[model samples]
Each structure stands twice: as C-alpha cells, then as structure tokens.
Target: MSESHQDKQHKARQQKVKQQVDARIANATEEKGLLLVITGNGKGKSTSGFGTVTRAVGHGQQCGVAQFIKGTWENGERNVLEKLGVEFHVMATGFTWETQDKQADTEAAQALWQECKRMLSDASLDLVLFDELTYMVTFGYIELAEVIDALNHRPAHQSVIITGRGAHRQLVELADTVSEVRNVKHAFDAGIKARKGIDW
Candidate 1:
C-alpha cells in the first residue's frame, strides 16, 4: 500500500479506539468510594495497595493503614505515609509463622480488626488500606462474616483497599473492583532473599 493510504488507515483505527475509550470514560459518571480488592500469589499485592494509599495522600485525602502479617517489619512506605500524618498501625508480632501460636494470632488479629473498624467508622477518612488481611480470614484468625459486614457497612464516601493473597470468594464477589495479580516470576524462586525497602 502507499504511505498516504496507510497513514489514513492508521488515523481511522486510532480514531475508532479514541471514540471507544471516550465513551467508556463518559459512561462512568457515578461518584462514590470503591471497595477495591487486590489479591493473588504475586509480589505486588501490598505494594499496589500502598501505592493507592500514596495516591490518596497525594490528593490530600485522609488514609488509614493496618499491616496484619507484616507488622514487625521496617517498611519504607509506612515511614513516608506516617511522616505525612496518615493514620498507620503496625503489629509488633509479625507473621503467624513467626509467632507459632494460634490463640495469640487470633487475639492479635481481633485487635487489628478493631483498629480496622475504627478507621472504617471514621467518615472523614477517604481511604483505608487493610494490608495482608486476606490471611486473617483464610487462616480463621477472624470471622469472614464480620469482615464482610464491616466492609458492606462502611461509609458511602469512604474508599477501602484490601490487599493479600487468596482473598475469600465472598470478598471477590462483593468488591466493586477486583484485581488478580498472577505470579509470573519471583526473586525468591532464584534463591535470593527478600531485600529490605523493596520487598517490605
């Protein structure tokens, strides 16, 4: 084909794509907080959740974050977000495997859930990040029904992001936006330990 004809065809195809994208953007006009779930066995679940929290902070929106399984770690995201005056809480006991006590893990999870509820009830908070919370339900540390109820009853204008692996079926069903991050590769698979500031 001639160069001019190809250019015209390219322009036509691009115009069609632009129109479709414009229609999609125009059709989504409703304004409200979203219950977004980021789940899978990938490496970026918590990272993506924290990224959303940072975005909210960039917009001057209030954010609340509670790290369940990773409470004991020295985290870069927590350092910056807390420095910026975002409501952040961390558990000192760390992961359940480290603790190795089912009862204690359950108690700590309940306490964290109370903190999550406190943030959920706060209408002023624009976003809440429940970090590594999927394990709480999956491990039976907290009742799934309670979590569902709390999420369902959250303030109309308050957005929430739940990040962890193996999210409950009900949660996937309930979420307005559900993202499944598939695992393609990992540094751990190559025998490299998790690096600080990047992994945590």
Candidate 2:
C-alpha cells in the first residue's frame, strides 16, 4: 500500500476507536451517584459547591448545604438557594481566623457537621454540599473517621460534594471524583476586595 494510503487507514482506525470510547462513556451506568471533592488554596471553592447545588435544584433534585467556616449574614448564593427551598445550615461562628477561638469554632463546626451527616444519610436528598468541610478535617476539628463513615454509608443514589482547602488524602482517596482548583490569580492578592455576585 502507498505510504499516504497507509497513514489514512491508520487515522480512520483511530477515529473508530475514539467513537467506541465515546459510546462506552455515553452508555456506561455502572456509577450513577458521585462523591465530588473540590479542594485548593484558591478562590471559588464554595462558589463551585453552590453552583452544583443550583444545578441540582434546577434538575428538580432535593439539595442540602452545610457551611463550615463562613456564617456571615446574607450572601447572594444563600439568598437565591433559600428561595429555591434548598436546605442550608451555617456554622454560625463565622470564619475561624476572625473568631480566633479554636474550641468555639470546633464546637460550631461539629454542630453543623451533625446536620450535614443527617442530610448525607437521608435517601431523600439527591445532593448534599459540604461547604468548607476541608477546614474542619484539616484542623482536626471534626473526626475524619466519622466523616468517612457518613460518606460511605450514604444512600447509593445520593451525590455528595465537599469543598475546602487542604483536603485530607484519605478523603480524596475515598471520593469518586476529586478536583483541585489551583490558584492562578486572584483580585484579593492585588488589593481588591471580593465583589458582589461575582465573588459571593
């Protein structure tokens, strides 16, 4: 066969293989529910979590959200999600750095975690977002073993999303999908405060 003809045949074979792979991915239903862990030192961790919550709500799925470190009043996402009947539980102690009390923060985190655990185990909830959850595990404020147990024990058809910086290796290993949001750049580093709708 001519060299060009051979190259064309190889390309055609590669296209056929690609089509088969795509078909498999499209038809595969072995894994329906997912454990998604989003972690990194950049911005938008909770934002990404909330985005997923919104998506789930739009799809007529019951969703729950538990905020770990942030408990400040009236964020746009919370307001929108609340209007959609999405369940939300905040830590009520605000950020750890602002509180400057480890014990107090831990206690608040534990309380919120209890609610999150219940939501996670509930088969009625299609999706549960654990916002800033990595902070609890990273600081040892919440028991890692208990968290793993709750995640593993959740309903087979339920999806869970955990977002925060410094996610534990064990949690990452347990997760069905893990996404690391790298910090390429941020306005905060340039002396600009977080903007409404965009940041919040």
The best candidate by lDDT is 1
Q: Per-residue lDDT of 1-200 in model 1, one digit per residue for the tens? A: 56698899999999999999999999999998999999998889999999999999999999999889885668899889999989987766777888898888888889889999989999999999998899999999889999999988889999999999999999999999999999999999999998988887
After superposition on all C-alphas, the RMSD of every candidate to the true structure, in Å, is 1.7, 3.3
Residue 63, candidate 2: alpha-carbon lDDT: 93
lDDT of 2 by residue, 1-200 (tens): 56698899999999999999999999886966799999998888888888999999999999988988876766898898999999988887977889999988888888888898899879999999998998899898999999999988899999999999889999999999899999999998999987878887
Error of 2 at 44 (Å): 1.9
Candidate 2: which pairs clash?
A: none
TM-scores of the candidates are 0.96, 0.89
The C-alpha stretches of model 1 lying farther than 4 A from their native spots are 1-3
Candidate 1: worst-modelled 10 consecutive residues by lDDT = 88-97
RMSD of 1: 1.7
